[model samples]
Target chain A: MSSLILTHTRYQMLEQMRIPISWVASAFFPAASMLAFVVPFAAADPVAATRATGSMMMIGAISAALIGLSITVSQDREQPWNHYLRTLPAGPLPRFAGRIFTSMAIMAVAVIPVLVIAALFTEAAITWPRLLLGIGALLAGSVPFMLIGLFLGFTLPSKAAIAVSQLLFFPMCILGGLFLPPQIMPDFVQALSPYVPSRGAVELVWSATTGSAADPAGLVMLAVWTVAAGVAAVWAYRRDEGRRFA
Target chain B: MAVLARSAEVTRRYGDVVALDRVSLDIRAGELVGLLGPNGAGKSTLINLFVGLRRPTSGTVELFGGSPRDPLIRRHVGVTPQETGLPEVLRVAEIVDFVSAHFPDRVATPELLDRFGLGDLAKRQVGGLSGGQRRRLAVALAFAGRPKMVFLDEPTTGLDVEARRTLWDGVRSFHEEGGTVLLTSHYLEEIEALAQRVVVVGHGRVLADDTVQAVRDVVGVRRVSLVAGTLPELPGVLGVEHADGRTHLVTTDPDRLVVELVRSGTPFSGLEIRPTTLEEAFLAITSQETTSKETTSEETTSKESTHV
Candidate 1:
C-alpha cells in the first residue's frame, strides 16, 4: 500500500509537470500581489514587513491547497481512468493520499516566489529556524483548505468547481488578514474575522514568524472547521461513489 | 472445471427500472463467453455486478469463490468498460506502467504494448492518440495485469476492421494462454469470431445460454429464395416475402422445402437455399422473445379486465 501510494504520488506529480503553465499560474498571483502591495509599503518596517510576508506566503499556500486540489479532484472524477482506479484492489486511500501529497507539493512551489521576494526586497527579518518553522506552520494550517478543496472537488462538476473555487478564494484572503490587517477593516468584519478558518491559519503563521499573539477563538474555530471539512470531504466521496457505481 | 465467476438469481433495479431480473449465470474457467443483448438489456449492469462495482438488488454475485468486492478476488480479475477515458497528460507507456504496478504479476510492458501493436507510440501522449488507439490501450491494460478472468464490454466499439482483427489477436492469445473472458458486443460477427459459449440477454433476462452453435440452432432460420412464378403451400414455411421477382421463403428446413419444390415440379430455374447468417439468426431469436413477451402481457391484461 505504501508503494502504491508513492507510485500514485509520483505519477500525479508527473502529470502536473506536463502542464508547466499551471505552476506559473499558481505561483504568479501571490508573488505578484507581494510585489505590488508589500514591496513599496511594508518593506521598511521590520515587524510590518515580516508579518505581511508571512500573510502573503499563507495566501499562496492556501490558494494552491484550495483551488488547485479542488479543480483536479473534480476533473479526475469525470475521467474513465478514475473509474478504473476505484475498481482496483487499492481502493481509494492510496489515490486520495497521493492527491493530498501532490497538493502539498503545489503549495510548496507556490510559496517560493513570495519567499524570494520577501528575502531580497523586504526588511522582513527572521532566524533560519523560525523561517523553516513558519513554512511548516503554514502547511499545517492549510489543512482545512485542503479538505475544503477535496469536498468541493468531489461534490461539484469540474466547470462548477472552477467557478466556486474562484468565488471562495478572495473572501478567505480578506478574512485571513492577508490583504490588510483585520484591525483596519470594519468593526463587524474584524469581529467576524476570528471565526473564519483563514484568520486562525495566518495567526499561526504570524506567531511563528513575527511572535504575534495568537487569538484563542480563531484557533478554536480553525480546528472546528478542519474537522467539519474532513467530514464533508468523506461524505462527498461516498456520495460520488453511490451516484457513479451504486 | 472450476467456476471463475457466478451470479445466483441476481436481480438489479435502478429505482423503478429493473435492469436485471433474477438472472443466474456461471462462467467456467478458460471459457470465452459472449453476452448478447440489445440496448438497455442489462449487459453492462450484469458486468458491473461481477466486477464488484454495484451490488445486486437481490441475490449474490461472486468471483473466484469470493465476493468480487474482496481485494483477493479483484486482484485476479480485469475489466474494460464500454467507454474508457484515458488520462490525456500521461504518455502511453507511463500509463501502462502505472497500472501494471498495482498487480503482483503482470505481462511485461513491452510484450503488452507489442501485443496491442502500441510499441511504436509508447512516447506519444494519450491526448494525442486517436480514439482507436486509446481503445486499444484500454484493452491492452486489461491484459497487462495478467488476470485470470477478464470482462470486456464492447471492447472493439470504435475500431476499423484491421484494428478489430489486431485486438482479436490479443484476445485470442490471452485465451490461448488459458485466460477466461466474458465480452459483450452489438456486432454478432465479433461474438461469432471469438466467443466459444454464447449467452443472449433480452428484457433484463437471459433468453438463451448455450454453445455458440447450440444458440444458432435454437434460432432455426433458413432462407429459401428461388424464381418460382407461383408459390407453393410448403411445410415449415414461417413467412414469405418477395424481392426482385424472386419469392423469399423463411423456413426451418430449406433442404426439405427444395425437395418438395422439385417433387411438385414447380418450374424454378434460379434456385438458392442458404442458412441464415448469425445476424439474421440473432434478430430471429430476440424478436421471438419480444413476441412471446407481448402475448404474455396481453394475457395478463385480459385476465385483469375479466376481474373488473
Candidate 2:
C-alpha cells in the first residue's frame, strides 16, 4: 500500500513537472507582491515588514492549495484515465493521498519566493525556531483552503472550477486582509476580515513569525471553516462517486 | 472450466430506457468470449457492470465468484474501457508502470510493451503518439497487471490493419497462456479471429450466444433479390423490401422461399440468391428483434422471428 502511494505521488509529481509554468506562477506572484508593496513602504519597521511578508506567503499558499488544487482535481475528474484508476483494486486512498501530498509540496514551494524577498530586502526578522514554526503554521493554515479546493473540484466541472476558484480567490484575498492590514481597512471590511479563512490562515503565520498575539476569533473561525469544508469536500466526493459508478 | 465472471438476470434502466434487460451470461476460465452488439445495445453497460463501473438496476453481477463491486475481486481482472484517455504527459513506459503497480503480480514493463509492439516507443510521451499508437497503448495497459482475466471493450476501434493485427497477436498470446478474455466489438472479423464463442446482444437483450459459426447459422439469412411488381406472401420470409422496381426478400431458407415464390405464379426476373455475410447475419438478427418488439405487445424472445 505504501509503495502504491509512493508510485502515485511520484507519477503525479512528474506530471506536474511536465508543465512548470503553473508552479512558477505560484512562486512568482508572492515575490512580486513583496517587491512592490513591502520593499518601499514597510522596510524599516520590523514588525510591519514581518506581518506583510506573512500575508504575502498566505497569497502563495492560497494559490497553490485553493485555486491550483481545485482546477487540477476538477480536470482529473473529467479524464477517463482517472475513472480507470478508480476501477483498479487499490481503491481511492493512494490517489487521494498522492494529490494532497503534491498540493502541499506546491504550497511549500510557493512560499520560498516570499521568504527570499523578506530576507533580502525587508526588515522581516525571525529566529530559526520561529521560522520553522511559521512553516508549520502555514501548512496548518492551508488545510481549510485545501478542503475547499477538494469541494469545488469534486462538485464542479473543470470549466466552472476554473471560473469559480478565481472568483472566490480575489475577493477572499482582499476581504481576508492579505493585501492590506485589517486595522487600516474601512469599518465594514475590518468587521468581515476575521470570518474569512484566509485571514485566519495569515493570523497564524503572523503570530508564528513576529511573536504577535494571535487573534482568537481568527483562529476559531479557521477551525470552523476547516471542519465545514472537510464535510463539504467529503460530501462532494461521495456525490461524484454516486453519479459515476453507482 | 470455472466461471470467472457471470451476470444473472441483470437489468439496467436509464430512466425509461432499458440498457440491459434480463441478461445472463457466464465467462469461463480460458475462454475467449466476444460480445457483439450495435451502438446503445448495452454491450458497454455489461462490461461496465462486470468491471464495477456501474451497478445493475436489477439482478446480480459476479466476478471471481464474489461481487464485482469488491476491489479484491477486481484485483484478478484487468479492463480497458470502450473509450479511454491516458495522461498526456506521461511516457508509454511510465503509464504501464503506474498501472502495473496497482496489482500484486505484474508483467515486466519492457515485456508488456514489447508484446504490444510498443517497445520502440517506450520513451515517447502519450501526447506525441498517433491515434492508433495511443489506442494500442490504452489496450496494452490492460495486460500490464498480468491479470487472470481481461475485459476489453472495443479494444481496436480506431487502428490500422497492421496495428489491429499487432493487438490481436497480443490478445491471442494471452489467451494461449490460459488467460480468460471477454471483449466487445462491432467488427465481426475481429470476433471471428479471437473469440471461440460469441454472444450477440440487441436491444439490451441477448439475441444469440453460440460459437462464431453457430451464430451465423442461427441467423442463416440469405438475400433473394428479383425484379418483380409484387410478390405473394412467401414462406420463411423474414423481411421484404422493394427498391428500383426490384424486390428483395430476406429469409433463413432461400430454397424454401424461392419455391413458394414460383408456386405463387408471380412473374419475376433477374433473380439473385446471395449468401449473407456475418455482418448481414448480425443485422438481420438485431433488426428482427426491433420488428418483433414493434409488432407485438408481448415480451419478445430472441429466437422468435415475426414473419412479414
Candidate 3:
C-alpha cells in the first residue's frame, strides 16, 4: 500500500510539473487577489487585511482541491490504470489513498504563493505561531471540501463532474463565507451555512487568523460531512470496480 | 495426474441477459487452445472470468489448483485483452515499467521492447503509435512477466502478414519454453495454424471442443474433383455434381475415391482432394444449434397458443 501510494504521488508530481496550467492558477490567483486587496485600501489595518487574505487563501486551496480531484479521478477512471490497479494485490485502497495524498500535497503547494503574496502586499502579521496556525487551519478546513470532491469524482460522469465542480465553487464560496464574512449574512443563511463544506473551512480559517478558539460546532459538522463523503466514495468505488476498461 | 490445466462450470448474467449458462470446459496445460466463436458468444466474458476480471454468477472457475483470483495462480497468468487500453499519455517505456512493477521479478524492458520493434519508440507517447504498433506493444507487455499461462483475445487482429508470422514465432517460442496459451481469434487459418485444440462456443455454451483434426473428422466429408472424362459412382459418396467438364463428389472417404479414379485410368487430367476445413465445421455446429433453438422456441410458442 505504501509503495502504491509513493508511486501514485510520484506520478502526480510529475504530471503537475509537466502541465503549466495548474501552476499558473495556483501561483497567480491568490497573488492577484491579494494585490487587489492591498492596492485598493492602503490604510486598512494589517490584522484585518491578513484575516481577509487568509480567507481568500483558504478559498483558493478549496477550489484547487475540487478541480484537481474531479479532473484527475475522472481521467483515471477513463484510463486503463484503474482496471490494472484492481488486478493488483493492493486493491483500491492504496490507489485512493495515493490520489488523496497527492491532491493534498498539491493543494499545500498552491497555498504557499498566497501566503507569500499576503506577506508582501499587506501589513499582515507574519509571526511564526500565526503562520503555523494559519497553515494548519487551511489544511483542516480543506478536508471536507476534498472529501466532497472525492464524492463528486466518484458519483458523477466526467463531463458532469467538471460542470458540477465549476457550478458549485462560487456559490458555496459565497454562502460559506469565503467570499464574504459569514456573520454578515442573515440569521437563516448563517444557520444553513454551517452545513456547507466551504462555510466550515472559512469559519476554521476565520477562527485561526483572528486568534479565536476553533468553532467546535462547525468542526463537528465538517467531520460528519467528511465521514459521510468518505463512505459515499467507498461505495462508489466498489460499484465502479471491474467495470472500467472491460 | 489429469492433463487438464484448468476447468470451469461457470454462469454469468447481466440483469436479465444471460451472458453465460453453465459453460464448462477443461483446458490442458502446454496445449494452445483456441476459443472460437462469433460475436456475443460469451468469448470475451469467459476470458474475463478466467482472468478474474468478473466473478461468475454461479459455479466455479478453477485455475491450476485454485480460483483465478488466487494471487499464487495469478502470478503465473498473463492476459492481452481484446480492447487495447494502453494509457495514451504515457510513453512506451513508462507503460512497460508500470506494468512490470506488478510482477514478482523485474522484467527485461529493453529486450522486450526491442523484440516488439518498439525500442526506438520507448520515449514516444502511446497515442502517437499506429494501431498495429499498439497491438504489438500490448502483446509485448503480456510477454514481459514470463507468465506460465497467457490469454490472448484476437491477438493478431491488426497485424500485417509478416507481423502475424512474427507474432506466431513469438507465441511458438513461448510455448517451446513450456508456457500454456489460451487464444481466441476470428481467423480460422490462425487457429488452424497455431492451436492443437479448439473450443467452439455459441449462445454462451461450448458447441464443440476437440483437436483441430478431430473437429474436421466430426464433419466427416471431403470434396473430390476430377476431370470429366470418366467418373465412377462410388459407394459412401454423399452426392456428385458435374460442372465445367469436371465431376465434384462429396464423400466421407476421399482416399477410396482417389483409388477408384486411378484404377479406372479414365483420362483425368486433374484430381484435387481437400478435407473439410474448421470453418465449415464451426458454421455447421453453430447454425445447427441456432436452428434447433429456433424450432424449440417455435414449438413452445405454438403449444402455448393452442392451450390458450
Candidate 4:
C-alpha cells in the first residue's frame, strides 16, 4: 500500500513539474508581498518583521493548499483517465492520499522563497528551533484550507472552482490581517478576523516564531473550521461519486 | 462453458428514462460476444453495470461468480469506457506503467505495448499522438492487467479501416488465448469480423441474442429495386422508398416479393435485388416489433433512435 501511494505521488509530482507555472504561481505572491510590504515598513522592528513574515508564509501555503489543489481536483474529474482509475480494484484511497501529499509538498516549497526574503531583506530574526516550530505550526494550520480546497473541488467544475477559490482567498487573507497587524486594523475587521481560519493559522505561526501569546479563540475557531471542512469535503466526494457513477 | 460475467434481469433507470429494461446477458469464458445496438440502446449502460461502474436499479450483476462491487472480483476484469482522456503530459510508457502497477499480476509494459502495435510509440507523449494512435493506446490499456474478462464499449468507433483492423487483431489474439470479451459496437461489420456471438439491443431491450450467422439469418432483410409506377401492396415488404425513377423495397423474403411483383402485372424495368446492410436490417427488425404493437409504454416514450 505504501509503495502504491509512493508511485501515485511520484507520477502526480512529475505531472506538476512538467507544467512548472503552478509552482511559480504558488511561490511568487508571498515573496513579492514580503519585498513590498515587510521590507520597507517592518524590517527594522524584529518582532513585527517576524510576525509579518509568518503571515507571508501563510499566503504561500494557501496558494498551494487552496487554489492549486482545488483547480487540479476539479480538472481531474473531467478526465477519462481519472474515471478509469476510480474503477480499478485499488480504489480511490491511494490517489486521494497521493494528491494530499503532493499539495503539501508544493505548500512546503512555496514557503521557502518567503523565508529567504525574510532572512535577507527583513530583520525577521529567529532561532533555528523556533523556525522549525513555526514551520510545523504552518503545516498544522494548513489542514483546514486543504479540506476546504477538496470541498470546493468536489462541489464545482474547474472554471467555477478557480473563480470561487480566488473569491474566498483574498478576503480571508486581508480580513485575517495577514497584510497589516490585526492590532491596528479597524474594529469591525478585528472582530471578524478571529472567525476566519487564516487568522488562526497566522496566529499559531506568530506565537511559535515571535514568542507572542496565541489567541485561544483563534485556536478554537481553527479546530471548528477543520471539522466543518472535513464533513463538507466527505459529503461532496460521495455526492460527486453518486452523480457520475450511479 | 462457465459464465465469466452475468447480468440477470437487470433494469437501470435514470430519472424518467429507462436506460436498460429487464436486460439479462451472460458472457461465458473463452467467448467473444458483440453487443450490436443503435445509439442510446443501453449497450453502454449494461457494460457499466457488469464492470461495477454503475449498479442495476433492479436485479443482479456478477463477475467471476462474485459481486462486481468487490474490488478483488474486479481484479480479474478490464474495461475501456466509450470516451476517455489520458493525462496529456505523460509518455505512453509511463501511462502503461501507472496502470499496470494497480494489478497484482500484470503484463510487462513493453510486452503489452508491443502486443497492441504500440511498441515504437512507447516513448511518445500521449498528447503528441494522433487520434488513431490515442485510440489504439486506449484499447491496449484494457489488457494491461492480463484480465480474464474485458469489456470494450465502442472500442474502435473513430478509427480508419487500417487502424480498426489493427485493434481487431489485438482483441482476436486475446480471445484466441481463451480470454472472455464482451464488446459493444454500432458497426455490424465490426461484430461480424471479430465476434462469434452477437447480441442485438434496441430501445433498452435485447432484440436478439444468438450466433453471428443465426442473427444474420434472423435479420435477413434484402432490398429489391425496380422502375414501377404505383406498385401494388407487396407481402413481406418491411419498408419502401422511391428515388431517381426507382422504387426500393426492403423485405425479409425477396423471392416471395419478386414473385408477387410479377403476378401483379405492373410494367417494370431495371430490376435489381441485393442484400441490405446491417443498419437497414436492424431497422426492419425494430419496425416489425413496433408495427406489431409489442412495445411497452416506456419504449414508446424513449427518445433514443431505433435506427443506426
- lDDT per residue (tens digit) for residues A67-110 in model 2: 98889898877666766776788755677668777887887888
Steric clash pairs (candidate 3): none
Per-residue alpha-carbon lDDT of candidate 4 for residues A13-42, written as tens digits (9 for 90 to 100):
879888899888888988899899999999
- Model 1 agreement with the true structure over A15-98: per-residue lDDT tens digits: 989999988998998899999989999999999999999888888887888888889899877665665766666766677778
Off by over 4 Å in 3: A15-17, A22-43, A79-81, A128-140, A163-175, A203-211, A241-246, B1-8, B62-73, B81-84, B221-271, B290-308
lDDT (10s digit) by residue, model 3, range B52-149: 65678898888777766655567677767333566666788977776666677656889989887888999988879989998898788777677878
TM-score of chain A of each: 0.94, 0.92, 0.88, 0.93
As a whole number from 0 to 100, the lDDT of residue A151 in candidate 4 is 88
For candidate 4, the chain B TM-score comes to 0.85
| Residue B152 accuracy (lDDT) in model 3 | 82
Sorted into a CAPRI-style docking class, model 4 comes out as acceptable
lDDT of 1 by residue, B24-61 (tens): 99999999999997766678778878887677889999
TM-score of each: 0.85, 0.85, 0.79, 0.86
**Candidate 2 C-alpha lDDT tens digits along B1-308:** 89999999999875556778999999999999999877667777788788886778899999999987778888899887323468888898998899888888899999988887889999999889988888888788788888999988778988989888888988999999999999887688899899999998887899999988888887888989999885777887777878888888888899988888888898989999987666678878888787776422221321111100
DockQ of 3: 0.13
